[model samples]
Target chain A: METELSKRLGIEHAIFGFTPFPAVAAAISRAGGLGVLGAVRYTAPGDLARDLDWMQEHTGGRPYGLDVVMPAGKVEGVTEADVEAMIPEGHRRFVEELLTKHGVPPLPAGEASGWRITGWMEHVARSQLDVAFDYPIKLLANALGSPPADVVGRAHDRGVLVAALAGSAVHARRHAEAGIDIVVAQGYEAGGHTGEIASMVLTPEVVDAVGPLPVLAAGGIGSGEQIAAGLALGAQGVWLGSVWLTTTEADLHSRALTAKLLAAGSGDTVRSRALTGKPARQLRTEWTDAWDDPDGPGTLPMPLQGLLVAEAVSRIQKHGTEPLLGTPVGQIVGRMNSERSVRQVFDELTRGFERAVDRVQRIAGRSAS
Target chain B: METELSKRLGIEHAIFGFTPFPAVAAAISRAGGLGVLGAVRYTAPGDLARDLDWMQEHTGGRPYGLDVVMPAGKVEGVTEADVEAMIPEGHRRFVEELLTKHGVPPLPAGEASGWRITGWMEHVARSQLDVAFDYPIKLLANALGSPPADVVGRAHDRGVLVAALAGSAVHARRHAEAGIDIVVAQGYEAGGHTGEIASMVLTPEVVDAVGPLPVLAAGGIGSGEQIAAGLALGAQGVWLGSVWLTTTEADLHSRALTAKLLAAGSGDTVRSRALTGKPARQLRTEWTDAWDDPDGPGTLPMPLQGLLVAEAVSRIQKHGTEPLLGTPVGQIVGRMNSERSVRQVFDELTRGFERAVDRVQRIAGRSAS
Candidate 1:
């Protein structure tokens, strides 16, 4: 399961496990794969520093990475107040009405839990990066697009590799031009923001577009067989996100949402713009349906959309509204039917990859490897 | 590449090349793969009879298949006129206005083209099947759903294997329960009518749902590596549609449409109900865009929608209106950039499959076979 990229990164497998939970990230790193901690949830720099410190201790000197949602250009000067003021009254009224219709109560006073738009601000991301550089991070990945040139240079200066997620060949070429070390070719079936291309088409296209640069296949990849297919499609490894959500090491903070995810089928997920301004694949809930209703107001742009729904989402989680409880998950959620330790999942993936290799070899008229 | 299904079918490779042209179908069979000709375009039973006779002579005794669009229940008593009478006047005017706006003129008198809704009617499908049984067709496949139990029985009685396209595990289970010999796991990125699940997720799910019964992986499979990936995902064979659209053996009739497909990228295709009452993937054109417009009258259900647009589509092709000309295709159109003989394409697929197998074997810590 190892590739040149894995060898360079000092990891044992080609699996890149992405999680917002530092515990899951540390566990993945300790289990012989690169674990990348997502920084979008850490609004305050000190919170990210605390998690990294914890990860540093728990990972047992194993390599781990950090993921930041940095827009291609500078995202400075736009304050949270400015983003809030941009939301229309009609949009606000629609959200309020939607909550009322669903009988969802407001969040308790002084209990803040939903997303903070300021986390997406450039200053906040830079502060998180500053704290990240203080630690021994092996890789830095951008969620939205290629990071700024200066950021890439700074990461390289610290001997850290830069990676970016691309949903199409065009975007992959752009990342290659930006000197990103690895391209995560995330497809439409991926959680969070994704483009129209599926991994079957996008992986080969990206690999062809940037031959020398390694590509990690992502989206709808849960099993070890999918990892083999990714490598078959010329990807150096597989980048998985949703599969980790059900792992014992993950702390989703809501048991109700976890139950819903376990019971969902592949068709249960929908790609909607309700989560952020961009189209993102998530569990289809009454909340997403309401946003898609023809008569209802459409979703607002990013930062603004997140701002408007942050409280409503918190309330939905607080109340455990069965129909509205959901989290961003890929179509692979259909197979994440039970909870398992990160080590267990990792072993199964390796076994599946081996079986797939033997299967393909036999099919090609050769004896099973 | 051989599988149990391919071995039983007496084909050299586990590739199911689906095309609407008899020439392409014959060439695929001669190239050591199963060629399944789409029977929906044959309005006259005699025409299908003639093509089957031609296929018999050209295939050199190699195995081929026939695909019919038969609904689960009987579709008796539905004439083309009856279906036309049910279309709303608003919808008719919308199509007329769209054509006029695009400067697409009406079809020349008596030069009837486009689709015939009657071809989808039960009587027509049965007639086509009756003519098909006279030939040495090795497989009988239904495009929409599992053929009625009697039809499956009839195919089995004739020593023909029956296969049905299923978009989900539930649908695959139904097909298996109906005693269909094979299930084609068609995914969201497939040409023509497709469900929401992409091949990466759908293939494994369908395979898991129905084991011992062979599954053919379809959608976004245009290369040997994808075929290898499909086999890795547990499918016995790969079913392809869009990849053959540009093959030298295919006769698209309209050079404009063929040129459009060759020049298009994977992202250029869209899944819209604008073609039929059901969502079908096709090359996105101004015609599709006009139907998708927010202000336009929404698409009608299947038969009526096909009836309303048939003449307009004929007109668009008749006039060679560049912006309005398109055809059913998959996201794999991105790679169908050149025209080649069916044998050439088959050779490339085999080579690519071998490369993928060797690559996976190497990655799995075994020396390349």
Candidate 2:
């Protein structure tokens, strides 16, 4: 099951997991796939330091990646004061009214929850990157855009491979020109901020745009079949995010886990900007529907939107609001109906991919010996 | 190269071509793939009958399919007068103005160019279906929706297999329930009318939705890597549209053919309602730009939009307006950069698919013949 991409990263397979849980990340790395910890919520220097320390101690010295939310384009220097002013009163009122309607209670007074405000600032991301350098990280990935020259330079200096997720071929070229080590072609079916392009069209285009640069296909990739499809499309490997959300080791709340379980099919998720200012795909919840209404108050830009919805989400998560809570996930959430451990999920992926390869080869009238 | 789909269709390969070019369709059928003639333009019974007669006489009695545009939903009986009246005066004026600004000339009076009006009506589609039944057609496919029960029954009576193109898993289920023999999962990157879903997500979902029915992957599929990806995603075959537009057998105007050649990359196409009043992907042109303009008059719905753009398109084609004249094509138009023959395209697809199968099998640590 070793691929060129896995060999380069010193892993058993090219399956890379992007999870918010360090335990899941460590498990993936330990099982011989590149486990990438979602570092957006870990923007605090102290918080990130402790998390990375835990990952290092738990993963038996295996290599892992960290995904930071460093958007390539954003307004600079807008603080909490500015973000509050930018958000319309109607939008703020709408969030408050909906949370109250959904029976989500207010947080205790004099105790500001860490999840109440957004950590989406580029400065915050830079701080997280600063923390990542202290650890023995093998890969540094940016979800929304190409890393800045300083970040790229510093990572290269530290001998850490840089990867950037792209929704189209043009963006992939930008990553390549920025001296990135890998181009992750993320398609529309992906959970986070995604472009209108799909993986089948985007993967090969990115590969063609940045030849010789390793490409890990993201979006709608959960099983071996999709992995085979990505590889056949010239992608070096597959980077998965949503499939890990429902796994046993995922640190999702009970409400979020329940929502993921009841997803009717792949068609259940909607790509909306409600959760994070950017159009990140997630399960259709009341919170999303209220914000996504075309005639209703529109959303603010990234950090501002994040700031506006953060408290509401924490309330919903804390109260275990039935239909008002959801997690950032991809269209692949439909297939993640049952709960399984990290080891079981990894084994399923590898086994399915092996079976798919064998099936195609047998169809080609070839023998697998 | 033989697949269960091709074996059932009695073809050498599981590749299907959807084109209006009789030469191209006949050639694809002659070369061991299903060649489907686009019958939306053949509203007149006499015209459709003649085309089928010509096809039967030309292809050495080889089997070919007819693709009729029968949308699942439409107005019952709207006459030409009702359609004309429903179109706003400003929208009509915008069409006339855009065509005149592009230097397209009007047709001579009484010449009655065949391309003056759209044949997207249910009545028109029914007439085309009537003609399809009269021929020895092997397959009957509906582009916009599932075939009517009566139409399905009639096709079955004639031993013709029925297929429908779906943009989602839900649509695939409807088609299967309607007694469709096959389902074609068309993705966003496909030319003509498409849905928001991409092939990677849509293909597997549709395959899962319609258990036993054959599924053909379409949209953004022009290469062998894509073909292999389709097969891996569980499609029995691949349906190609835009790739054939650039082939030598395509009877495209000299100007349109040249425009197809200059398409820089896959990013050159846009999915807009300007062409058929539906969100179909096509090469970007001034004609599309004017209709896509938000400040200008908005597009009319369905048959009305088709009625409005029909004459404008004919004038552009006749005048050979390079920048204004464009063809219905997918994002794969970027890869359709060169002028290739039908045989070459088919040969390349098969060879590429075989090599991809071998490559994946080897990566899986399996033996390939």
Q: Which pairs clash (backbone N, Cα, C closer than 3 Å) in model 1?
A: B277-B302
The DockQ for candidate 1, computed on C-alphas, is: 0.85
Q: Rate the local accuracy (lDDT) of all candidates.
A: 0.91, 0.82
RMSD per prediction, one decimal? 1.2, 2.8
Quote the positional error of residue B314 for candidate 2 in Å: 2.4
lDDT string for model 1 (B1-369, tens) is 989888999999999999999999999999999999999999999999988999989999999999999988865576778878999999988888877888887777778876677788888899998899988789999999889998999899999999999999999999999999999999998999999999999999999999989999999899999999999999999999999999998987788888999899989999988988899999999888878888888899987888888878778877889998999999999999999999999999999999998888877778895
State the lDDT of candidate 1 residue by residue for A92-209, as single tens digits: 9998888888899877888886667667777888899999999999999999889999999999999999999999999999999998999999998888889999888999999989
Off by over 4 Å in 1: none
TM-score of 2: 0.92
Docking quality level of the chain pair in candidate 1: high
Tens digits of per-residue lDDT, candidate 2, B1-369, equal 566777877777888899988889998888778899998776578987887888898777778898987776667677888887888888888878887777788976765555635467778888888777878888999998887888899999988899999999889999999998999999888988898777888888888889778899998799998998988888888999988887888888665556555565777778888877778888787778878886778677776888877877777777788888777788787788777889898999989898888768767766655
Per-residue CA lDDT of candidate 2, range A1-369, in tens? 666777888888888899988999999999889999988876468988998999989999899999987866667677778778888888889888887777788977865654644556787888888888989899999987888888899999998999999988899999999999999999888887888777888888898999899998999898878888998888888999988887778777674556555464677678898977788888777778888886778788776888888878777777778788777778787678787888898888888787777656655666644
Best by lDDT: 1
